[model samples]
Target: MGSIDSYIFRTTLTSFAVVMASLTGVIWITQALRGIDLMTSQGQTILTFLGLTGLAVPVLILVIAPIALMIAVAHTLNRLATDSEIIVMNAAGLSPLRLFRPFVYATLVVSAIVILIGAYIAPDGLRRIARWDSEITADVLANVLQPGRFAQLEQNLTIRVRERQPGGLLVGVFIDDRRDPNDRVSIIADHGTVLKNSEGSFLVLEDGHLERFQAGQQEPALVAFSRYAFDMSKFSRARDVAYGIREHYLWELMWPDPNDPLLKQLPTQFRSEMHDRLLAPIYPFFFAAVTFAFLGLARTTRQSRNFSMIGAVLCAFVVRLAGFALSVIANQTPYVAGLQYLLLVIAIAVSVWLIRRNVVIEPPARLVDALNALTASLSRLVRRPMPA
Candidate 1:
């Protein structure tokens, strides 16, 4: 590639990386917050919590990459136009299509990344997350049987142990169960141990006394036992992992097993997801074309490029929103999926035509004048001095 092409490509790619990271990090933090209970209540280590939450980053990148590419393309085009580089290139016999080549390369790179994540990495991450969650929830002894801390295993149920012995034995165990509205059961045990077998999980308590208090009666019934088995199966989750449509690999989606229970149940969802992943890579190119069509023109500073930038952003937003809407509709009407391809085809065709013809897109005269008037009003309001 020529120096100019390399320069444009580098700048655009750098911008894309920066924007993609910023957006993904911010959104990932918000998503991670929702699962903070992994560390806060589930007794998971910080690294484990972060690793589990970090598995979601690939999916976020799959969604954010296209938007970041669009923004990067817009930034590069606006910079070229602002410095009259586009005009200079035009004067030097560089056609609009030639000037657009660098952006196309950058878009291709981003699209490949999106495709990789969407087709395999993202779904793999989701599946691993499901597996991790199952393992974490099913290991109830590790998560709930802490010494000296009352662990809220579930709503209205609490377990606490004064000490834990070397061999997985719990000492001075206390259980409070108020799940039933009429009866509140409390058990104090001298020692306990968790047992998991083919039947289910159970907390076997030795030398325990059980006290039952009914809502209506002031007196409480008590029972003493040498050995009591408290049902802990409810607190333990099933180890079986069930994956959603989004968790399927691309090949699995493409050539799904007919007997797969989830596919058999939500066949429409499978179809929609397959289409979405297939079309994921094309969006970056579409976004780049749309952005360049609006912001690639060489106009004087007096022309005000703000409206052009806004138009580009709004057009990109509308196109993406339409794609999302169509994807949703495709779940119900299978044929509707074709409309997304048609939409992108038409948009990219129009954008390419406009770029080739050097067509400039501008707002209507009336809208411009109204915006100018509103800006003046706002300026006056800001400049107006406060009364003493």
Candidate 2:
């Protein structure tokens, strides 16, 4: 690679990395806040929240990488054109295809990253997060260990222990089960024990009265019992969740088990998910094609390429949105998979043709004129005096 190639490649790669991380961090924080209730209501620690949220980063990276590469390519090309560096190279007999080689190299690198995250990192992260959430929810000690405070174990269940003895006995146990909309239960016992079995944990309440209230009426029906086994599963249901298509590993998706009931139920959905992951690496280069297709052969004048940049952004947006739609449609109709690949191939072909021809996108003067007229009318409306 020449000095110019090295310079453009390095600058674009750095810009892509920075943009990707910034966008991922911002989106991750927005997503992580949804899990804050785990700590605020469910008595989870700050570290636990961070751990669960951190596991989602690989998924975020998968979504952010291609857009970042496109932005980086467009930004670097615009800067070069504005500084007349591209013109200098053009005068020295550098072809548009030659100028785009560095960006293609960068795209190759970014594509590898996308593939790695889509195939391995994201699925593994999701699996770990599922396990973490299950363990936290099923932990009887964390949910009900406090001696004098009522802990809201989840959305509908609450428990309070007056005292916890040294030998794993709970005294003055109070449990409120409001999970059922039709029947709300309140159980108070002299003492209780927490026991775990193959199915789940159970809170064995001794010498307690069960108060059950119907949905509409407030009056309660009380029944006394020597021993009552209140299934702890009702309080928290963080058991082994049936793994969905999104949660399956790449290999699992590619070679689905026909014996598996979930796979048998929705084969196309699983196949769509697999293809989505497999196609992750291709779109980055396709985006690079669309990006450079707009601004590849730099203009000799000092005129702004704002319109060209907007055109490139719109093109990229349309292609990506179409891909996303195909991903959804492919779940039901697998033939959308062919349409997705076709769309990408068309974009790539047009991009290469434009680069070879050195085509320059011009501003849409009619749209610009319309926008200007609208703004002028708005300005006049704002400045006009009020009627007496």
Candidate 3:
């Protein structure tokens, strides 16, 4: 690459990084918000919450990396035109193909990153999330206690704690049990701790008083205790956890176990996931190609290029949407995977033709003049005011 191509390449790569990071962060926050309950109600620490939510970032990047590249391409090209840099290059005898070389390099780099993220990084994250969720669900001690909040296990059982200390002492513990309609029991303690043993987990209340209320007796019976223990096994018992096909490894998706019950069953969905990942890396290049095709040439026109930009955006949108549709169809028929590659080839071909022509895309001259006249008439009508 020459000096100009090198400069453009650096600029495009930087823009892509910035855009991809910004997009990933924005989307990740929205997705991660769903896990906020882990910290608020599930007794999970901040670190645990972050770790669980952070697992989704790689997948988010896989989905948005291509879109970021296209935006970066459009932005770099537009900035070049706005600063007349492209015009200067053209005057220096730089052909359209030569000028577009930088974007091609940047797109390839981004595509490689997409391949890594889609094939390995993202699936690994999904697997981690599955394992983490399973652990949290099985850790009964952490699952049942929420500091400074009243947790209602059911309509009759209510538990509240004023706060919890670092050493595992729960302060101001209150438990109201009304499961037996005839006899109600309420327990209040100055402190409590959760203990796990060979048998099961137990919530042990210390320095507490237990009160019993018998219905229709109109009098409450109260007794004090040094220590009281309640079984917590129901809250923390481990159960079977199921993972989605997305959590599976690439090889698992490719050569799924025949005896594995799921692979033997809904094979179509597994095939669809595999094809989508394999084809993701091919999209950034074509998306960049389509965007560059519209504004590949540097024209001296003072008119707005908004229409041309919109046209390019719509064209790319249509192509990508078609690819998504094909992926969906492939779930039913694996043979349709070929159509995705065919679409990419056709898009690249047409884009190459557009770049070769090196002409500015716009509406007909007559249409532009007519639109200008119409705008003038509308301006006059608004300025004239109602008849006096």
Candidate 4:
């Protein structure tokens, strides 16, 4: 490659990297802060929260890369234009397409990275987070029975144990089952082990006495046994309590069982989530296109350039918001599914326009001049006049 080609390539690549990193840090920090409350409620540690939240960085980058690219491209070209660098290159007969070849290469590399993240890395991280939540819930529920205290497992069932250990072993275990009006059963065990089998989970007791009470009789009947078993599987279901849609993956969400009472009937969110995953990989391309638009409009002042970059970013976000709103509305009407493709096409058109208009040393002078005049007029209206 020639010196000018190498120089433009290096400058644009450096700008893209710096911009992407800064935005990723900002987005991750903001999301982590907002999610801290939910994490705490789930008993997730700070490290786990950070790691789980960090998984979302790839998705964020996928969204933000195009914006950064647009800003960087705009800034790089604008600076070159302001310094008369573009004029030098143009005078030497360097075409705009030739100059943008390196940039196109740079954008393709970024797009590939975004695709890998959205498709594989992001999904894997989300799955890990769901599993972590499942394990934590199980641990909390299994530890519900405390030593030396009468802990009520349910409205009619009270359990008191002197000591508890791993492998479902319990010492001085007592269960008071008042589940029936006609008959009541009380059991005390010297030593017990929780056993999970096909019949369901049960606590096998050793050196225990079982007492049965009948509604018609005043006295209770007691029977002693060397080993007795008490069913404990009913408590196991509580450990599997899922928070909501966030707990399941695409497949799990789609074919949920008819008997799964906890699963809400909102199939829209699941469909939306599936669409979101499929659509996430393409966001980088849109961002890149938008970046081109921003870069196409160049200015002399750094502050002015910053303002322009912010404006482009905001506009992109507005487009995203509109698409999301449309997706929600579409769930109510099946015909709205077409809007997703419409959003994608719009993004592609914007990118193409940005490239076509800004690929050269600068965009057409008349268009730039008109935008400047409009902006100046808008600024004047918003500005307060000084007292005469």
Best by TM-score: 3
Worst 10 residues of 1 by lDDT: 37-46
TM-score: the better of candidates 2 and 3: 3
Question: How far does residue 238 in candidate 4 sit from its true spot (Å)?
Answer: 7.8
Candidate 4, after superposition: displacement of residue 207 in Å? Answer: 20
The C-alpha stretches of model 4 lying farther than 4 A from their native spots are 1-14, 33-47, 78-84, 141-152, 157-275, 297-311, 343-347, 350-388
Measured by TM-score, how close is model 1 to the native structure?
0.81
The C-alpha TM-scores of every prediction are 0.81, 0.76, 0.84, 0.58
Which runs in model 1 stand beyond 4 Å of their true positions? 142-159, 162-172, 175-238, 380-388
Tens digits of per-residue lDDT, candidate 2, 163-190, equal 8775558899988989888999998999
Scored by lDDT, the top model is 1
Residue-level error in angstroms, candidate 1, position 91:
1.0
lDDT of 3 by residue, 29-65 (tens): 8988998988766677889999999988988888798
Error of 2 at 247 (Å): 1.6
Question: By descending TM-score, how would the candidates be arranged?
Answer: 3, 1, 2, 4
- Cα displacement (angstroms), candidate 4, residue 315, comes to 4.1
Which is superior by lDDT, 1 or 2? 1
